[model samples]
Target: MSLPENFNGWEHLQKTYMLEYNRRVDKFFSDVQGNGDLSNVRSSLKLACRLVDGDNEATWSLRTSLFFDVIGYSRKNLSIFYGSNIDTALPVAGHPQLFLYFSQDSQAVPLNGKRLDHEKSCRLTRYACKSGQSLPAVTKANLLDIAHEIKAQFVSGGKGIIYTAGKLSVSYTDPANGFPKGTRWLVNSKSEAIELYGKLCNVIDRPFDINKMNVNTPEKDSTTQVINTTDTILGKQYKQYAYRPVANLRFRYAYVSFGGSASPIFLIDTTFRNTALIA
Candidate 1:
């Protein structure tokens, strides 16, 4: 869809863009599940290119988020590994190829101790399938190709394509209140996530520092606490410590790779404090 000429503010534009983005994401998965065809996926990618063709904050954000979505999809579904040195010499028959890799100087070192020259080798976004079947370097121009390769190598060929509903279940503590008693919100897009973060910031009268928040992955569980202090100095000094409203966002993924059980309660979760956080 074409961006509207007349719009509200950046947030409004972002919300509008996210609406379309979510629609596309849903449609992509729907098509994949419906018939395993990628024609509509290619069309959607082309439309994304058109939407993000310009050099602007909105377009840049869309492009970056779209790429991250692709990466997230791969991480959630495929059994891929990432690092500077990955053993690619040993070939496993019938096993899904590690389609993602990082190599220096467009060269990859195989387990046989041979340095193979590859023009497409990139630091983190390189895509390589079998010999003579390599895609171009991951870039905005090659997103469609990269996506197609990811599907062909990982999703198809009986490689065990895992599927999720694509909903980020979020439950955050009411910053006005304390933990163990908060609210939950289901987020389906990045814009909604940003809006939710804004709401939490408004409640606390401060910007939320995600770095300070705790995370509870599928493998492990954790907790956090918020404390306040007050001091009085007269003839002597006195101090009082109490609890304050502090929120921590947590993420939990339901993929088996993340240590999830066969049957998961939720595909993903974003909880606050003791509550489940968004992913």
Candidate 2:
């Protein structure tokens, strides 16, 4: 297989460049691609190159760059493609303004441990209802219960609910172990939840009954009333909140494969067959 003129075999990425570039690319993929890692893309690129001629220095380099290019494409478009236009991987609260700062040296930053790119700056908009006045009168127990129920809803993986209430903030602890840490739920508050419920009620033109929530105990009297409203407004709202447009916390991390033999970085393939020939 002939290599493109610009192609250079697997340009050895400095440990730092390899780490930071892969971290951002992986995050973009996870957010947009539904999978946090890209084993398939990486493996496919390598396999495609191997199928051509892995032993050839030029082939190896071209395929390696192609791998990174696919990842780079995702990274460059991270801001463009997301679950929502208004959404961001950074916590919406606090910093209001966020910038990912990386070292200019490129080789300075290390791959391991908490890197600077992981550092986030945000100013949480404190706890307040839509009125921007006071937080709802949701009882702590009720709030905790709601959080627990939401966390429990995802049986495949556990998540933590971050609740900001006035000066004091709390998170849903593991019911089984009583600790407050999990893979997701970095930005959540009781106030936002109450506001969401209120918005839901307004949108559906129905009354929201906390007691009717799955987190609430089924009261026969309330159940009958809610059931009467269920098929219409109440049910729609429930489904909307429980299933559709549910907010999630996105965390960025470097993508790693089990082999650990290949560099995590990816690039665009520059083989003659893949690219247009220069005049």
lDDT tens digits by residue: candidate 2, 36-83? 233454333334422132235665466446655643442341222212
lDDT (0-100) at residue 38 of candidate 1? 32
Residue 264 of candidate 1: its Cα lDDT?
Answer: 14
Write model 1 residue lDDT over 142-256, tens digit each, in one string: 3333334333432334232321111344444332222122233333344444454443343223454444333222322221121234366766654343221112222211111
The candidate maximizing lDDT is: 1
Q: How high is the CA lDDT of each candidate model? A: 0.32, 0.28
How do the predictions measure up, each by TM-score? Answer: 0.17, 0.21
Q: Where does candidate 1 have its weakest 10-residue lDDT segment?
A: 116-125
Candidate 2 residue 277 Cα shift, in angstroms, is 44
Candidate 2: regions farther than 4 A off: 1-61, 71-77, 81-131, 136-152, 155-279
Query: Which stretches in model 1 have alpha-carbon errors above 4 Å?
Result: 1-65, 68-75, 80-247, 255-279
Candidate 2, after superposition: displacement of residue 203 in Å?
A: 20
